[model samples]
Target chain A: MPITITKSTGQKELLNIEKVKHACRRAGASAQLCEVVGQEVKQQAKDGMTTKEIYEIVQGIISKEHPPVAARLNLKDAIIKLGPLGYDFEKYIARVLAAYGYNTELPPILQGACTTHEVDVLAVKDGRAAMIECKLRHEIGIFISIKDTMSTWARFLDLVDGSAIGKCPHIEECWIVTNSRFSHDSIQYGHCKNMVMLSWNHPKERPLPAWIDDKGLYPITLLPQLEHNTEKSLIDGGFVLLHDLATADPSLVAQKSNIPEETARDCVKKAQLILQA
Target chain B: MPITITKSTGQKELLNIEKVKHACRRAGASAQLCEVVGQEVKQQAKDGMTTKEIYEIVQGIISKEHPPVAARLNLKDAIIKLGPLGYDFEKYIARVLAAYGYNTELPPILQGACTTHEVDVLAVKDGRAAMIECKLRHEIGIFISIKDTMSTWARFLDLVDGSAIGKCPHIEECWIVTNSRFSHDSIQYGHCKNMVMLSWNHPKERPLPAWIDDKGLYPITLLPQLEHNTEKSLIDGGFVLLHDLATADPSLVAQKSNIPEETARDCVKKAQLILQA
Candidate 1:
């Protein structure tokens, strides 16, 4: 059935529902799943809206579908998008790399009982595969014991052994990424072949220019560079934290740079949530 | 009458009740208040505590004793020794002045809620007064807004008008310190007779040297001298927050520095509390 749809501006669109339904059945999802999503899309889709935003709306609806094969598919996509630990470490790694000018394709991280085990990030510059292992700085540099450091080393060893991702040929160079600095002994333990460690602590060699002003770019490497005198003068003159930018202090930053005052007030709501949690 | 007491390790000493009573009276506190603190400090305070720590213990007990008067005395002392906002702003200005080989006691900053006027700093060295106004930044080669740039000027105007910190009798040159490049407007605004605007944003003009390996030299002017390319870089590399170092992290750092953690923490805490307020 071909249907006419109207947008908020009074523009009209026509979509073929029968064609999509048949396509959905052929693709193995229930026809009802396609109908609900298709119906909503026809009703709400605006003229010239970006495909990515439309996809996001569909994704949101998928997460809310009843009897939920759509929800299962949403979970499947989420598992692929953000593997485990409530966030996709692989995606974050891809972001950090992208922010660094690397071409990368990343797979969902392999999940374990406690945390994600093997993160699958692929750096494809000029179509050559560069496999990376992703790690997050769950804790910001508060070291309780040496045991935690040793465990991270062991996880890398397991990735090297090819246990995290299922057996596959066409493997490339393995990169281990972390948000925190490696404890002194952990770096010593990472002396294996085909292993490169990138961390906020002891930033190893990376290919990013100092001109790019983002703080997280070459996170750890920049620290040692900053220990360099020239860089210090440049940064010290005009640095402001994102949080500080959002403050009510009129003299600290431009008014627009300050997020809406309500957003900061929302932090109080988050604090309340923590209290409730 | 003297009372005999045994230390935790069984060392014996005679305590003078009169001295204890007098110390409590000097602290404007009672014996019961002292006992309550003694119990908590036993759990919180460790061995080889300093006289300042003991004073803080007494002060904490007597905190309710004329809070405003206690606050005023501290404020007056900050004006005299530390300048406005403390953290050795006077020392930073002294270095800046001496760089051009000038001698100067800057005017005292008026400290109280009852006054709208505040001065950036009062520098006292070699028998002359250099009233200095300073600002800090984390970005390189950026312009600040006119509205945001007025606090330092407002404070300076307050001092010049003789409404802030009484009359500035030991008058010398007015110095403006900035961590970033001053806008064209800021330079014009700073162009009053006897005013010198110094931007730390320029490398040669940077009063601080690059790569100071000396831990003893870290100060306000010298801070931008260290080789940190970004704020997070310095923070993550264990650049301790003055407040965190003094109050919460002192016990942790005491393991490294020979100073008693409590006293170190308190000093850092007192300085930060004043800055934030």
Candidate 2:
């Protein structure tokens, strides 16, 4: 039977079980599991099915089989839903830094050589401070260009110069953090300038996704069925991570978000599964 | 007297006549001309002066002393004003190619291996066909990235494959034309793939600026006092090149652009002087 799969944007496309199976396999699902999911999905599928509906169906099965892989595949889309508010991204990064034993500040004004600069994320650990330039990309295709990397480098230099002149505290390190990939030139410039670069998939030694997974610091947006308003409330209530939700009482989540208790319970359950994976 | 000059975006800074002179010198002005212009500009300048106003004053002087240099300096800005309309840029590229003895088409639909691709500018000359990808940047700081280069290569390969399958004529060359610089990776990718890159300042042997200046095919944005609407009308009327405007009857241009005859006359005069220089 032919069925139209609707995207989160409300645009619809004809559902292709083969494509779904391929995606599942790419996410590290076993071939046998992929076939089983594909067959089940086809039977349950209906015309004008929303992608969220399809995702929920598939994720439910995948989380049961291989929870970690499900979380990894869902990460990109989860990060994207956190937006329309850039400040929240800064907060999220601050939280990530905090998990690594760094006392983090969102955006602090520090005197640069020429002017006052607002450093994105300031992390202090072991008596050394790092001025991090947090570049958040909502779109997957957007790569951090060389110009941005250069601008960060200039800012770092200016801040260092400020410290040399005793205008601000001396920074021991500079870092560029992004949720997406950096352009080749950016990577090269960062390495040459000795600025630590952390991206979603880079330096392989300490990628952002692996770091987030290790700390169980997934953004609240990663919880499936978390409404936009609820996400905002959770963030405002100082609950920004999936780990927070996984550990919180489901009733507390429902009260904070004004969401149905059963839905909140379901979300908490998914978060727990993802964290375990 | 010191004056704080302002930018179009309202950013203000102290005016420096020496900086203006340096700009003129970089634009190929003579030392004497630069000095004279600097003195004249300083005298005419006041606090709260905009960069646009300064450009006009300096351009007026340079066009009188060295028209070609004036045209060359104005080239980058002129090409920029051709947008918000990307199609105008493609047409501008077509005119440039035409000057080089190539008949060009804008966005001709050519079959790729799996899908139909709309080639940006297809140039035919000497019994060889070239598929050109015209990458235009509206902002100055944006650089063409490696992903774009790779996408163009993929399209070129698909087009070549299409020819193998008898879907279209064989393309003997693939070229990327941009009015901005390309990232290091883009340049490297182009070289490795043997794809010809023609940018504002790349491939050192022949840059876009040099090619346009050599052909005397300056875009009409070079006209100092050309109103935005009139420029659009002139471009729409097929008067894309400065050479075309310079050689056309002033009355004809006035009629086409719905502007006064005298203004058209002055524009043509400036164009002629620039060409002579």
Candidate 3:
């Protein structure tokens, strides 16, 4: 008889991204890890570390137990702290494609014109490099102008044409993305190239999926920020200037320009020694 | 039928613009005017002027013709003495449009944006304004990067939208222009209900057609340098160097991690005694 295989009947445990999100709490914390990632520890990547090694790099980036010195730094620095492991995410994405048994090379990003006009991640496998344009469109589209849409779309076309990059093969696809629907021309440009487009409008939405080898092209997913507003973020970051926001609005200050409304009240409450003859 | 009306035998006597050009020659000259229209004064428009007036303004502009000095100061000193004609060219374009019979306003220019963007002119007519954006495109487009296209297209959109005009009325049209062909998307944005997209790329193209109007709608055609590229108009009005062009280009010099190019060049060219040592 063939070797029998058994399937576990117990409740399947799910690996939720939320569980790892605690990592965000340590975002600004600094000890040694943040420093390593910030510098992009180049030597580590050459060692052939796996993707798990990369997360470990970011995990090692900020020691929660330490002070928040690293918080002021950007994402690149966090990667550097991982030593060689910091470069994991990119390699992981490449590896996912590699698992499909296709040859792939993640080339160094050239400063000017190589793939998509403002491509976020460029992956080369076939003769044509499919430009992967990434966007975390913070500002909404209803707020942008049509002219902006046109110019941006034109740039996308230029990206597909490879006018700027001398010899990076070509961007067979031109993708445009947004946190929400942009004006018309943006979508039209992509249609002309028959490329994929992605836009995210709310939290709890699954963003684009990753590109797979042989089966399908890149996945489209939406990312949404939860329980996060500008004010809350600032407060959590400990960047407070005043406790009361109403006082900050000038119309509350008796039409005066210089004095803060609440502060003016406080000054009135304080005793002043003024005697007139 | 009286003496046969002999149409004056075509002696190729002279076009009115040519006659005005000759009279302007008697008046004086401007380098920047020549830079745009060409060598002869006759090249300037002549449909509405008294001929003498255009000649006088042209004379006022040419530094070498120094009115009181009788052309003795040479071109150098006159260059220094002149100032940019604050007579807005866009407004002039509008006037020329009106002079020929087009009803239009040049649009109001937003003040305080010149540090990065500039509005050369603004004219209004027919309850609408044409937001004309102009520039000479000779710069090289090197590498295309996320930020590069982002910024370039962003600027292009900004120009077309007339976002620079802080208090401009909601008019019927906006025109973004250049001395080059526009991409398809640019044409699309120009399709807005109240916008127009135009360009002048032909070898002998005269942008802003001279005969678009019959009775003329705006009428300030006497200014020769207003045609385009008038450095003397720049001089006639007065201007200070924003940044030295030669020093801005890095390929001209290889040295790095040193003092600014402008300062270095100043020292090298002006300080001769130290060089002898």
Best by DockQ: 3
lDDT to native, each model: 0.41, 0.80, 0.34
- Candidate 2 lDDT, B170-241, residue by residue in tens: 898889998888888677767766889999878787788877866678888887777888788888777888
Report the C-alpha lDDT of model 3 over A1-277, residue by residue, as the tens digit: 1112121222233322332233333343333444455344232332333334434544454433332222222232222221222133343334434555535454554332323233345555566565444343332334223334434455555554444446344555544443335445444434433555654321124322222212322111100111223223222332121212222333333234243455434322221100000
The C-alpha stretches of model 3 lying farther than 4 A from their native spots are: A1-130, A133-149, A155-277, B1-61, B64-93, B105-175, B178-203, B207-277
- Name the regions of candidate 1 deviating beyond 4 angstroms: A1-277, B1-108, B111-116, B124-128, B141-145, B148-151, B163-170, B192-194, B202-277
Q: Highest TM-score: which candidate?
A: 2
Separate DockQ for every predicted complex: 0.01, 0.03, 0.05
Worst 10 residues of 3 chain A by lDDT: A268-277
Candidate 2's C-alpha runs over 4 A off are A1-277, B1-72, B254-266
Q: Tell me the tens digit of each residue's lDDT in model 1 across B141-202.
A: 34543323333443344344553445544445566665445666555545533356666332
Give the per-residue lDDT of model 1 (tens digit) for A174-216: 5556544555544543432334666643444441111112332
Q: What ranking emerges by TM-score with the best candidate at the front?
A: 2, 3, 1
Each candidate: chain B TM-score = 0.36, 0.76, 0.31
TM-score to true structure, per model: 0.23, 0.50, 0.29
Candidate 2 residue A144 Cα shift, in angstroms, is 18
Query: Model 3: how far is A130 from its true place, Å?
Result: 5.7
